[model samples]
Target: MHHFFSMMFSLLAIIGHVSGQPAKGGSERNIDRPYRSELTVSNGMYWGSWGYKSMCPIGRYAAGFSLKVESPVGRDDDTALNGIRLHCIDRSTGSSDSYDYTTIESDVGSWGVWTDIKWCYSGYLTAFQLKVESSQGNGDDTAANNIKFTCTGGYYLQGDGTNWGKWGNWSPTCMGKGICGIKTRIEAPQGKGDDTTLNDVRMFCCD
Candidate 1:
């Protein structure tokens, strides 16, 4: 009887996978992903590979982040923004200087240098907006160039990104508490073709 039940359970698991249902660790898109909200922007461009989802440790949430940006080099291939990294903290701790906090980021492009981290000073990150340039047609194209985040403390923080694109609409506010995970789309270096490093992004919120 035990063997029969075990076989049935295994068969059920296989059936779930075959039927394209969400598995134990993740959905059809990634593994070890965190709880996500539907809060996202509609202005992201399409030109890169989607990266893996990266989540903060449980009980922590994003309060700040930094940008990876390449300074403009005249007459050179310019990829404005390359990546974003989230700095997480435990709001319950109250002591913000603790060494136990964690940092998280998804895939990033190969250019640019990481900048100093920015923080909310009082609360966690709740929503975000992006600045993206449209297709240049024949000139240098830098897709996503800058970003801004809204904090739970009712303030906004901006990244130290390059200036090239127009700001888009903000994403929906977090449904739970604040953002806790991230995923990005980045184009690999095209060697000689126009390269628009960082493209689109998605943030996951947690309670």
Candidate 2:
């Protein structure tokens, strides 16, 4: 409901802004949806579903991120990583915190509170690595456990996530400028079995 309202308000805000202004003599809007490259984790785990990709607006790139993490559950079912969010900014402006830029995320599991955001001081996010626990036949299963992102400044940011898996190799760096979109795979609830919500993810790049 919140996401839906946010989208609606954004659309209405754009429409209102345009409608309230007089037409310029010879101005036009240019929409670009250029495809750059998609970054993927080679060893991501299984049994989850993919969601539609959510993208940052044109002229912006992801410079930060946040995670929806469910902390450890004693002996009960555990689903460590639940969702991922990409916070976008126009780095050329040199002010990621001055304005409240748009943020987007793909499908999110119905668990966990979003953690504090992590940001790149001067650049955008470039590459990523996932820590995913493989399935345990009859034991607890937390498919995706944690994540780490590399900033264009040559530093890494780790998530405040659970420790249940090994880290995978970093994904290929963005072929363009930086990451601009995201799509995630999530496992549905299992009534009487282990619940491992987040399984895999893909990051999209933009020029």
Candidate 3:
């Protein structure tokens, strides 16, 4: 009888411990997403490099991102990259988690400042979209064209770009579940006639 009681106590203790801890696998991730600033420009038609502008190694959903453009001649609107927005949902329920922008730049010809990083409403960032344009005359110009998102269940949202290329369709699924983190790829800036473009964005899986 004593041994039976001890076993019951142990089981209860284990259950309590499990319940006190965070639930993994399909649950929300509690990781940090850091932002980085970068610039890329091209001098000729299509000559530049693509690398990370910002990255968060820990597993976290891509709530959203802020874009920064450099234009030697004009403002943010006159740059090649315009702005970006998010389209996401609750990871567990799959319900729409829409977000509204409050600090959008007014001028369409010049990117004033780095717009605020927009995030998801209910769940981790699960998907995204982009807005881009062709490089202006002969000026050192650059823009962040696309972005990605990671979820809890290994699911992801990804996209890419080409010189003056139009926006593509959103990715169906990164892995299978939710978003974790993101890495922004960029093109290096060149002298005048820079035609830089954000090539692609990749998502990282959580541990």
The most accurate candidate by lDDT is: 1
Model 1, position 36, has a per-residue lDDT of 56
Error of 3 at 92 (Å): 12
lDDT of 1 at 64: 82
lDDT per residue (tens digit) for residues 1-207 in model 3: 113343355346435533562222334323344322221223122323433222232333344444543333333222344323222233344433333211111112122233345444444544444434445456443444434443334454443322343444454343423444444444432223343444344444332
Error of 2 at 46 (Å): 1.3
**Candidate 2 RMSD computed on C-alpha atoms after optimal superposition onto the true structure:** 7.7
For each candidate, the alpha-carbon lDDT, in order, equals 0.78, 0.77, 0.36
lDDT of 1: 0.78
Q: What is the lDDT of residue 35 in candidate 2?
A: 44
Q: Candidate 1: minimum summed lDDT over ten consecutive residues — where?
A: 22-31
User: For each candidate, C-alpha RMSD in Å?
Assistant: 13.2, 7.7, 19.3
Cα lDDT, model 1, residue 39:
61
